[model samples]
Target chain A: MEINHTVIDSVPILAVSGRIDATTSRDLENALNGLIEEDNNRIIVDLAGVEYISSVGLRVMLAALKKVRPKQGDLMLASLQPFVREVFEITGFTKLFLICPDQREAISKMKTG
Target chain B: MMGINREITVPARLGEIPAISDFIYEVMSACGFDAKKIMEMQLAAEEACTNISNYAYEERNGQIHITAAAEDDLHLTLEDWGTPFDPTSRIAPVTESPAEERPIGGLGIYLIKNCVDEIHYQHRDGKNILKLVKNKD
Candidate 1:
């Protein structure tokens, strides 16, 4: 997966594209780790561009959530494609993270709540 | 196994995932399988390939061989040269607990087993071979 990060009003937003399967999970783990340490632990991951995800990718996301949760911080997801959303729902991560239908709503939730 | 009915070899990397899935599904579909069957087979094949990429190779780079055949039924096999790990041997997904309470890794492999007709595993000569079959009849 290819990751690009931008700070929207000091909140780190990571835009990930391509597939996050076995080989690319580490890149995602590193990217999230960097943001969680540098920032105050709140993160918004834009998954609209990501096409596919496997269990390994799911583990990385779980690790990120586990890291940020203790700090009273969160990792939210935005705009998942159908296939990507299916994996999240199947894994029960849909309830754990704040998943919004669109990026606008996700960022808004992060800002307001 | 040199003259197997059909076989494919790919790097044990995420980049080759789609290619591997596509090839396996196409061959299965050509054997008169419906879309639902094709999808189930593809997902199972994909999960196995992903496992090999993640657990088998560790820090080292390696290759995973995928072989397919459409005799009376369709069969897909994934072979890797890395660690000796059997995904099927892992603990089953916790069916009693809710999704949030259950662990993350085993669900994919469990799903693979549920989808296919036959699930087989073996480690021979330092190669881990996994075969998933779906009967056409």
Candidate 2:
């Protein structure tokens, strides 16, 4: 998978493209780790380019969340496809993170809330 | 004589995930599954294969051996030499928590179990094998 990241008003925005499965999940983990190292506690993962996501992907996200929580930061999600949303709901992750309809909304919510 | 079981194996590299998912979809479709079933099976297979690639090896790259069979039913087995954790035995993702409180780690296994008709796991001969089956009428 290809991951493009940028800093938007102090928040690290990771725009992920490709299928996030068992094999490519580590790349994601590495990306998250980089963010953590940078002390960018507030994160927004844009999944608009992500065609698919699996449990390994979720696990990576969980690990990242755990890492950021101690620092009093949060990971948010935006623009999930229907199929990806279904998996999140099935696993109860729809409740674990702040999910927004789009990247702008996620960024706005992070700024305001 | 009975025909031999046909199989295909691919290396479990990060770049090969899409090919693996597509292969599983093709195998399920060839077994007469409808488009919806094929997509579901594909997602489940993708989840399992991705896990193998992500957690099976720490330093050295290892192969994820995938064997797909279509006869009386559809079977997709993924074998890896990584850690010996069985995803099938994992607890379901927390369901009672709200979107902001629920954890994120168990969604893949949950999706796999929910999408497939049958699923099993075994660690034997120093390999972790995840077997999934889907039947069609």
lDDT of prediction 1: 0.78
Q: Write the per-residue lDDT of candidate 2 for residues A65-86, one digit (tens) a residue.
A: 9898889888999999877787
Q: Write the per-residue lDDT of candidate 1 for residues B1-137, one digit (tens) a residue.
A: 12126777888877787788789767876677876566667767778877776688873689988888886688787889999978878747546454434443476786676668998889999999888889877
Tell me, by TM-score, which candidate is best: 1
DockQ, in order, for the candidates? 0.27, 0.36
| Top-DockQ structure, candidate number | 2
Candidate 1 residues lying further than 4 Å off, grouped into runs, are B1-5, B10-43, B50-63, B70-74, B80-86, B94-105, B114-118, B121-129, B134-137
lDDT of each: 0.78, 0.78
Superposition TM-score, candidate 1 onto the true structure: 0.73
The docking category that best describes candidate 1 is acceptable
Report each candidate's C-alpha RMSD, comma-separated, in the order given.
4.7, 5.0
- Please tell me how candidate 2 rates in CAPRI terms: acceptable
What TM-score would each prediction reach against the true structure?
Answer: 0.73, 0.71
Q: Looking at every candidate separately, what fraction of the true A–B Cα contacts under 8 Å does it contain?
A: 0.41, 0.69
